[model samples]
Target: MERISFCPTLAAPLNKSEVASSRNDKSQWKTKENRPCLMVVGNDSAAAGTLKEALGEWGYDVVAARNGWEALVLAGRRPVDGMLVDMDMPIMDGRTMLSELRWLGHQMPVLIMSNESDEQVHPQLLMEGAQGFVLKPPHFQSLQQTCRKGFAK
Candidate 1:
């Protein structure tokens, strides 16, 4: 898998010492209490990258998983505050993933994303343990708001 980073370019170059100091500062800041960590699971690399960028801009620690199995592994390895899962995926679909995660005793809030009309599937997904649903190809603001709502739940 290709490694993708959403870091923005700085206006000016920092010296090595400055860079190390900034990294140290960021590490300290990241440990603050109540900071949310988000897990994003999607098969589409472009969509995953866009969601990761938007959620990171909103101050969440974002982790991207290319499939459901990878998502489950990551969730088990870390303390995830919320999850954004694409309903359609290879290896495992979102519904199955949600079920399995619940079976494994993960109680973190989950939001489902789908290209299909929400009218057709959102209700059932919600019944199955997902806290909410977002339409795929999501607008930035909508996705951000939906994620915020999921975290609130």
Candidate 2:
């Protein structure tokens, strides 16, 4: 499947203390370890790597899963503040993953990413418990805006 290629200038990862202090009382950005973690699920290693590095630079602790199964294991094992999932992947696609997550009572906001046009499917995805849908080649601004709103509470 085609993936978005992002060109983010690498930024330093946030230290544990920095992550702790940066979060406010209202922010849902804390995990069991008290650090915010975001899970990125996709089969595109190159894209996932770039996205993970970029999110880390922005002060988020990022974890990656090559497929839906790995993602499910990680989420079940620990806290995930949010998720950025690609629509097409091996093993399981984004829709199925989202369904399973919700069925298992995981409520963290999830955003689906795809190269497909956002004409119809996004509405259905939203009904299925997604926070939003992002078209591939997603601009950082849109991603940041969407994430901030989702994680604000």
Candidate 3:
């Protein structure tokens, strides 16, 4: 199994008052305990590392998982505010992971990140549950905005 490295620049945890205030308003966008917790699942170590770094720079606390199975275990142990999952991987693919996650009652917003073009991706993934889809080597700003939108609602 490959190692998953996390960036070391995460923001401090949120205080109780802050959590209370954020939860009081359903319309307000809440960060995960001050910094949003993002789980990034992909098979390529280099790509996942790059994404982890970028997301960390953007103020997210990121957890990198090599495949969907690993992602599921990580998600089960902690609360993830959002997820960015690759469409293809060994052990478990993103689509199956999404289906399993939904069946298990995990409603965390998921964004599919794949090498496939929009036309190549299956429509069922979006219709079934994914909050959004992003092409691999995503534009940083666009990815960031998509993440923000997922957390907003």
Candidate 4:
């Protein structure tokens, strides 16, 4: 596994399928994402850095956004197949970002990664149609497994 160099999306014309496929070889990740895009939104540079490392190592194309507004703005123009969001973020919270995307009819599978150990990921709390949630800095293998599982679903 290698720590791929990720240049944050400063708003560009991104191809969804190309981005998703960059995470892994098509043969390894055969999940039906359909849309071909993966959005990773986080305020913490460290968290985003870790995810970029994972996603890059996984060989998936990634679009990194620093906050909720940026994510929504980027996602609006490009169709994302999947997304990983941080629960506590600046500008807008993860819940709000997810809600806005849903409102706009984006159906990408959104995964939430949070540092709030005391809080659990429940349907009632995850209002943005998010499909998965894993606490931050989980065991490396567990985090990897969780990400794989999320994309699988």
Q: List the residue pairs that clash in candidate 1.
A: none
Per residue, candidate 1 scores C-alpha lDDT tens digits across 1-153 of 421211122222223333234334434335455468888999999988988888888988889999887787666556677899999998778988887677556788998888877685778877889998888789888887777777974
Clashing pairs in 3: none
Give per-residue lDDT, candidate 1, residue 27. Answer: 42
**Residue runs of model 1 more than 4 Å from their true location after superposition:** 1-34
- Tens digits of lDDT, candidate 2, 1-153: 322111122122223233233333334445555656889999998999988987877767899999776776667665678999999998778988887677656788898999987678888999999998778877988877877777655
Name the top TM-score candidate.
1
Tens digit per residue, CA lDDT, model 4, 39-96: 7899878777777777767756678899887887677555556888887887777877
TM-score of each: 0.76, 0.75, 0.74, 0.69
Model 3: per-residue Cα lDDT over 1-153, one tens digit each: 321222122122223333334434543444556787788999999988899999899888898899877776666556678899999998778887787666545678999988877664557787779988888889989988888887664
Q: What is residue 123's positional error in candidate 1, in angstroms?
A: 1.6
Distance from true location, Cα of 114 in model 1, Å: 0.3
- Superposing every Cα of model 2 onto the true structure, what RMSD results? 12.1
Q: What is the lDDT of residue 131 in candidate 1?
A: 93
